[model samples]
Target: MSQIPMFRESFQHASKELLHWFPGHMAKGLRVMQQKLRSMDGIIEVHDARIPFSGRNPLFEDRLASVRPHLFVLNKIDLADMSRKDEIVSRLKYEGVTEVILTNLKNGQDKASKEIVSKMIDMIKSGTRFDRAMTSPSSYNLLVIGIPNVGKSSLINRIRTVHTKREGKAAPVGAEPGVTRAVQQGILVNIKPKVYILDSPGIAQPRVNNVVEGMKLALCNIIHDHKVGIDIVADFLLFYMNKAADFRYVKAFNLDNPTDKIMEVLVKIAVDQNIYHKVKPVTGGPWMEKLNLEQAAYFMVRKFRSGELGKICLDSDQLPTHTTATLSRQRARSR
Candidate 1:
């Protein structure tokens, strides 16, 4: 009989400093966003669905969202685990989030994407600033904001296509973080209510809370892979999957079995993918051919991002077992 091997119970990284990534553009963008806040009727803050409870910029909540009708659009729903969707929504609601929507912007015609404009308009009309919005009844201005690479630009383009029936992209988009360097002028989307959305650059927190949080951000590509080392990012992903008992990678990468060692996995990936580079020996002899583990690490992380492994929620552990409403009812019943 064969025995199952034990995996890591937790992940560890040497440096947490690699997680802090607030560049000059982010600071400048924050200032520009604040300047434009007075003109916006509402806020649509986009975030990665896989990381509903992680990597969100607190400054948005403290400075921008509180002053307007804010809606959290968790983008990339296609790649997230929806099994706990109810718990996620309930927890967000308990945390004082008035509105939340899960969406996959890649599908321009997705039901959630189609409903965004209407949802924002409804929120603006029913909010404390409805009278202010009424003053400009012909049009509503909204700002799309969030940490980098969570699809803020993509959302604007999707919304434009849905509302205006436009074929071309209204805002620029890229797979990498910090694609949009500054706030741009509003692009008109709806003709009836006259919706205009201003796309803003992704803003990350100046200091990350911890190394694990940083790794999560890196895994989502919110931070550059090199900042935290691609190898470390891949290692953390392995640990996370193993801890959750997810072994899809074994089949995905053609591994004989699951193992806690990242080097072994990367070596296998490198060999299987034919990723190699020439290396010079320290003894001043001839250069030798070696497997490129760095490239292999990147490939592994990319697979996870592309949903080849399976649906996953990085914040699944953070969700409350009992919702606030349930706890209240329980307390009342006990009395």
Candidate 2:
């Protein structure tokens, strides 16, 4: 429940109605973000530690290569699979990112933030000192980039200690998934060279096949938005849990006969949660109507990343095509 995004009404409806509705706005935002990125000395690339690959932006990678050096930040380590932290760390390093820093950026602890800042300084002084010398009045600039809802704004708020900014004045940082649709700067003064952190919009992965698959990759749990039960999420978790952990998840939930069909599994969960009201809709009355069980199961497995499920990595792998991929393959055949 705590993992649920804020402003539940809008998110719930948006999740249900427009989960796959990514428009040109993201492409437009990416262009703007790249334009703004030219000023920064390095990128503080944020990814969900749990799903690093999915959060990466290939466009950002290509665009930023010429602009600045990058510090790949694997954030939200607190919520990640404790057992696999070393493996995740190793995997990221293997992915051509040597300066990976594990952090719980949203919680705003000073120790982690300070270490992040220190790491940035060390990297800059080593490789970016000559670049810094060229600017007339250069301040230390770091581009904070990530996918939507990956805790970028929350991290900024914690670092600066300033809350919402006033109208027509410099705004205090706030946390919305895509809050910084256009890039904005936040100043942190403690560092010797003043730190100018560029907060950018969350970047969307390029559609691999069609928009629907892209939606599934970006928003996640698209089926849960349209459906009432957590069955899809459960099935997804069960499917991946077994893959990642090398054992099925049915034993944890105690479902003797596990079905691959999400709806079938959801019915079992409804019975287990003891809130399944047959007289009412399958959504389980008003209280559970908006509940997203698929997301819930993902959250539980996320809480304990024991590798019992299959390697359930969402991002940081091959870009997924899903429905969009299927459509693209079909189009290619026709061509």
Candidate 3:
């Protein structure tokens, strides 16, 4: 653990305002999802396994989840420290989550792919199919939902490849958040059980109530980097790395000790890795190359997201123990 007294006690954003990042597409996608609930047999709510608790939209619980059989899939497990997964799952179950799944969702077939397909089929077999009334189809229709860039598309593609005998992406995938701009329907993943998935645009809350949660989401690439500001995200990454006592970054970037200051780290990364920016004055001066801190921070954040800095769980120390609604209210009140 970071020595609390040695490092900064808390992270404070300069804005001191709520981080609200709902775009036009998210609002429209949500409306589309609520209308499609009657068509869904089950729900697979994907989240970053590193942030098992943060960045989930409580509105999803209120508007869409109540009427469906829900399964929470915490994705990106390859980049998370699962030492406390039992505690995480138990706490989620305590909050009345029907089921929780941990997934790695990589380029090739993995155990998680098969497990997700099997479990969803089982949930459809056993759990209630809400608003579909008495009649149900032989194949299952599952809706995939989560905050942005938590690997929802990757999960669907993995299941499709492993179970459906398909060879390519059924849904679009990208490195940045908000790549999924629309709610697409009937992405088939299985032929034997006749399973199909509906991929929805990732939705964030209108306002992120807590700054720490917002920082964590930004660090995990769930929020757009530009929207959160790369410097702030890098600072949070430094803070959490110290808090977790994960010094892999020190070796990764050839630093002597852990840093709480992101600027120093970013500059060092730029110097060591030769990252720079070309600038030309509006007055028509010659172009000059300068060490770019933002680019370096982006590089560092990518390292964390890609697991190059080492396996870290940004949310393990801060999992929400209370129900989603209760925590939402508490966070709102604090704001």
- Give candidate 1 misplaced runs (Cα > 4 Å): 132-136, 321-335
The model with the greater lDDT, 1 or 3, is 1
Over the stretch 1-335, how does candidate 3's per-residue lDDT look in tens digits?
23323567688874433387788999999999988888888888998888887777888889887777888988888898786788889987876687887777774656766788778777776765433463445677889999888888988988888876778888999988888899897798988768889999999888876888888888888777777788888888888776654567777888766677888899999999999999997889799899998889888988988898867777766764546664464334322
The global C-alpha lDDT for each of the candidates, from Candidate 1 onward, is: 0.87, 0.52, 0.80
Off by over 4 Å in 3: 1-5, 14-18, 128-136, 280-287, 319-335
Where's the lowest-lDDT run of ten residues in candidate 3? 326-335
| Candidate with the larger TM-score of 1 and 2 | 1
Error of 3 at 82 (Å): 0.6
RMSD of each: 6.0, 11.4, 6.8
Query: What is the TM-score ranking, best to worst?
Result: 1, 3, 2
Ranking by lDDT: 1, 3, 2
lDDT of 1 by residue, 1-335 (tens): 12448987767784655656898999999999999999999999999999988878889988999999999998999999877898888887876688999899767568998898999988998887679635559989999999999998888888887777887878999999999998999999898979999999999989888777788899999998777889999999999877665677887888887789999999999999999999999989999999999999999999999998878888877875656764464334322
Off by more than 4 A, model 2: 1-22, 82-91, 106-110, 128-138, 162-179, 185-192, 209-233, 245-248, 257-261, 276-335
For 1-335, candidate 2 gives per-residue lDDT tens digits of 01211211111212332333344556777777677665667777777665766446667667764456678876666655434456566766676676777677545344665566667767766774445555433467777877666667666655555222212223234433455566665555334456767677676564334322333343343122233233333444444433222233455454554334445455455456653322345656553343444554544433344333323344422333336554464334322
